[model samples]
Target chain A: MENVLNWITANQQIIYIVVLMIFVGIEVIGRVPSVLHTPLMSGANAIHGVVIIGAIIVMGKAETDNYLALVLGFLAVILGTLNVVGGFVVTDRMLEMFKKKK
Target chain B: MELNLLTLCYLIASITFILGLKMLSNPATARKGNLVAAAGMTIAIAGTIFLYEQDGEKLHNYAWIFGGLAIGGIIGTLAARKVKMTAMPEMVSLFNGMGGACAALISLVEFNHLSKQLAANEVEISAVQPTVLIIVLGLLIGSVSFAGSMVAWGKLNGRVKDFSFTGQNILNLLILLVAIVAGVILVLNPGQPLLLYAILGLALIYGVMFVMPIGGADMPVVISLLNSFTGVAAACGGFLYDNKVMLTGGILVGAAGTLLTILMCKAMNRSLQNVLIGSFGGHKTAAVAGGKQQGAYKEISLSDAAMVMSYANKVMVVPGYGLAVAQAQHVCHELEKILEEKGVEVKYAIHPVAGRMPGHMNVLLAEADVSYDKLMEMEHANDEFKTCDVVLILGANDVVNPAAKNDPASPIYGMPILEVELAKTVIVNKRSMKPGYAGIENDLFFQPKTSMLFGDAKKVLQDLCAEVKTV
Candidate 1:
């Protein structure tokens, strides 16, 4: 419990950012018309693909001799890249359909 | 100095995500918003690749990283571009699943690293307890999102059937509890690779079981919920790495997805808990409701239907998943144009939960170049129905079902539906008398004012278009 508290204190800035971002998310998403729900969802899905950065960091830092870390990191990179690229591309396609209406 | 530059890149990425999501709320700026965010993502990635260093050692293994990126990028782009509009809901589910899998894999890799560090006596168990908790959480939630989304994708595409047994909800709860308990134990112990894998296995089962019983009509809510789960899991990765861009993006998605889930449930007049546990559209309800009698319905000839729509002052078309299944949106749009050319006003009535996903019908109509102004939401459409001369229902059932309003014993009772009955005439196009995705019998079909025009939606719309042109 003490360690948890210390960790919380140590990461206070991150916690604050998370809390503030949550509010911003709700406020922004609340105004989206139902017509754009699917696209908005697809866009959000793409945003979370930021995890690819973590994948890159891990794969970069892992020692070449460490087979387990290297393999898992490689897989993570692939999946994360898929998430990032696929998410954005799919979202863009969905949104493209919406744009021609104007 | 280099770290500060990377942090600046992350900060720029975070701001663009917010700006992008903000612009997405408006149709005119939505496409641009997406591009801006993608650009920011590229900047973040470039900064991380060149500027990020750990202990004065920059990242290596460029060949492996770029190879994976290139392969995933090709597959993802091809799949997204080639997918049919009708297959969009499942495509989103499939892509979202990949994200969840990535998050779970990150947790696995990080946990392995932590275990190694602990073994080398480089990290204290007490100091790393919180990190372990986050890793366990990321693994559990990410695995569930991945597995559940796959099942949802399969269910959406008709490859998986809704399956539930007696005590299934109880069993689901038990599995989840066991997984959480195992996660807690792993957190406390810090180095049990076996225990971590066991939790992953349990979470995968829980995810599959969790989605197995949810009926097709309820997929929007399930997909949204799972989307949020993936977001939160990704946020856990951010927490582990202290990456501000990742944290912001993940939290934003988590919040957005959660709100969308609640909105979907509200649109159906259901609570989130009810959606998760009730499995409202499963076979059990279908069997019980099957015994009820539906009075005889009248059939409308295509020419007569065309005549009725041609003479009407205002025509409102209600579309559903069946229209998508028949790939009839283009033909339906053609019919609308023909009707309008005859001096009849044409508009579309879109139910909130229509089709497989939220705003699904709108996307279909938009693809066919239906003007956005002509599409009316349920509340506005309900008002318009009072003055509407004819309501042309194209492959829609439950959304226009009177049972939602009138029959208390109905599984979809209390759910809001388009009051198409308020119109002077209702022409329903269906292949047969089969129930809708919810498997509930629609009482509106038998009403005196309703006429069933039985045929495939696309063929019927095409014939209606030809007939309307003549009239």
Candidate 2:
């Protein structure tokens, strides 16, 4: 565990760069087949649950000087999570309109 | 105490964003998406404040940040609560504009910080190079989004000239020139406050100008496209602050917006170029030929029309924009109640794009608490209309246009329509014989099986409902 921590400490910046870059790559290439854009967009909107994750991380790891940041970040994430959950449910109901009859 | 709780929160917030996005496909689940996404955003914002330490110099006007968020949140909530559903497209434009403006403002504040440090000869300020890039990009896109959104709002509200102003486009061009000239000044001296304000100001003007010429019928497309721009601007702000959440949120909006724009094009049966250059749908030359004497159908009094419908075995109601204009949803509901009581089977036939905007009729019907089962989509209701004893049209046209049947030259050609004419007896209520948005007369009004009852839609419908009860 100690050795792993040391290696991670040394490579933190690179790791940040790599993860951020992958997200960017997804953004640039995230084309839903022309047929699936509406569905895909709705699907992707559901994934916005990450905002909640972001808020939690900020609040839980807050320092003494970052009290306000912690509160604001948590608030933003909670609101963002509600949006994701509601949006996904709505999207599924919408997609049902397109289902084929057996 | 030194836990990686912030990182975990960020991961959760990101997942919420994804979930919201997935749920946004259907209107029914859209609320859940919003709730979840809002929860995620709250979490992300809180995390930023709590988890992130201030290793660098803190911002001086953090209070202003909180103030802006509060004010924006209040205004957004008020608009959502107060605005009519019909006006939702315009309201969306207003919200999107606000988002862009916020991004631009935040970038400006950051830029100011960077320049102040540079002027003080602080060696640490050298690290602000990426901040400079983000600032410029944010200003450009945000200004456009803000201005464009306002113009779109105006167009949807049908006050084009008020938003466009006299010679607005020309003035916008001049502003762009000034901004370009200011850009050179900015490049020559990166710390010029005057230049910063100038370029940002010009960019804002350019946004309005770009959106001004667009017409009302294309508002959905315009708003969706601008939504994409707002997203990009937000992402740019994310880049400025090195915030992962902002980047992700911005990218998602941008991608979603582009996709929406494409869908809007399909709705209009045109390309993006056509939408931009084709003027709007409301005032095109009449798509169907008129002025030739349409055969006159028999006119019916309220009493006679009521008698015909009261005893009908099956009655189908085809609603159009006129029903909306007349605010007759309540009356229609009343009429339905009366008819159903008489053992008459009643159903509402709706077109895909019936009203000015998509699903306009559906929302109006939903508001009246009309039973979902009673409301039938066009395809489902078409064949049923043929066997019906009477088909009552309450202030509707265009969708009943026979132009789709025989004339391929019609603008609405190839679009599917409800065959109200298929009914054994048809009653059409309109104030005048004037044509619809396409400026084409309704041939269904003149057919043998159809009867025209000219009057106010709501009042006439009420009269019919009362008369149907007595009959």
Candidate 3:
């Protein structure tokens, strides 16, 4: 944990650029008209489901005998997975309705 | 070597996500965009499970990981497939809540482990200040988003009613203060397990209180705000681990949610502070204060409505949450088609704050396979109303209420609405004379040019369609 802190602090500039890049990237993607707001909200909701990776990384470093960590990590994985799957599926369902019929 | 590979995989996945989000901005490619993002998520998940390594050791517990993934996948797929279009908002809230719970649980487990390490005389707890800040922020924001989303879900699906008492706002503020104090103490002394629990408990309660007083009218903004909270909390998880993919994904969602929230507020003409205070939209019984009885409303039979529409040169259909409740979008679309066949030009009038959320009406109408060009936004729709021959409002109320434009005392005043009264003639389909979710009587209902067709929207639309064939 200490070593990673030192590394992140050292690379703080990179983190700043990445975060700024994303914020600007979203702004540049242009205006999502009001018609697509719901799907956009749902799709963005799915993107945060990436938190599952954080759960795995945390649990991977824990001791094998740590039952508490295992249970919490497992549930986190399940919940995060649900968010990713359901969020994307529902968003696709909504977006499909807007697709131009070929 | 394994860590470097994992980083590369995450990088590629993040790029795909960016592309997916970009694609989502346009209607033509939105579905394909969702698929692209889903593929990226799949790669990120698989890489983390199979390739991630730390301290020169690969991850174990494949059984637990895969088992959880399979179960969650099935549940999510079924829920998404089975949810009716009308309930999409609540479904989104539920799924988003789960993400928040995951972020909160991650912080909880990590904090527990860190405290244990401190007690074992291992690493200095003070040395991990950034980690502590991330854990505290994640714990607080994640739990708030989770609990608050549950309350929002309940409110949206009609299982929960807004609850408020005198001094509730003060109580909410106090809870926030206590939670912040607890977070500070926990950050200063990371070994105190009790302080962490206190922060979590306070935040959970605050989430509920924060959303308890907001009424249905403001739910779109509330939902958007909570979605942003989940995003920021997820980013905290990313910061804790220094994972670039996680950070990028979190930032993307966080930024998108924030933008959505701002847009929602703008659509409603309400400030963010007014929304967070949770004071608007709860008054349902305020009397019409002008002390004069409004004109009696007139009712039009289904046949008359059909005749009027058949003879009109142009018809604009205005839909609201009532249309959604009756599941009438399909029938409404059928009516549109039938009217179009009669040489009556048909268009839809959509309010920015129509239905339950922004773009909610578009989703409903699109599900009924209504063409994208026919669905007009509030600004565009308002402009066309003066030229429209007949404005047919189906199961909508406040969005057409002239009160929003003329009556400053009305709760929804200053909000943009469809100028339905501008049309030459107006026909509204509703079950009764009851007020809408805002509980304000619509002045448009009593206008000389406006006549109501009383019944369920679907049934009324069906009867009107049959009568139109006769006409």
Model 1 misplaced regions, further than 4 Å:
A1-4, A100-102, B282-293
Better candidate number, 2 or 3, judged by TM-score: 3
DockQ for each candidate?
Answer: 0.74, 0.08, 0.61
Candidate 2 vs candidate 3: the DockQ winner is 3
Question: Per candidate, chain B TM-score?
Answer: 0.94, 0.85, 0.94
Q: What's chain A's TM-score in each predicted model?
A: 0.89, 0.55, 0.76
Error of 1 at B248 (Å): 1.7
Clash count of each predicted structure: 0, 117, 0
Q: Rate residue B443 of model 3 by lDDT.
A: 83
Q: What is the C-alpha RMSD of each candidate to the true structure, in Å?
A: 2.1, 7.6, 2.8
Q: What is model 1's interface RMSD?
A: 1.4
Q: Give the CAPRI class of candidate 2.
A: incorrect
Task: Evaluate model 2: give its TM-score.
Answer: 0.75
- Per-chain TM-score, chain A, candidate 1: 0.89
DockQ of structure 2: 0.08
**Candidate 1 per-residue lDDT over residues B198-258, each given as its tens digit:** 9999999999999998876677788888998888998998898888888998998899889
Docking class of 3: medium
Per-model TM against the reference: 0.95, 0.75, 0.94
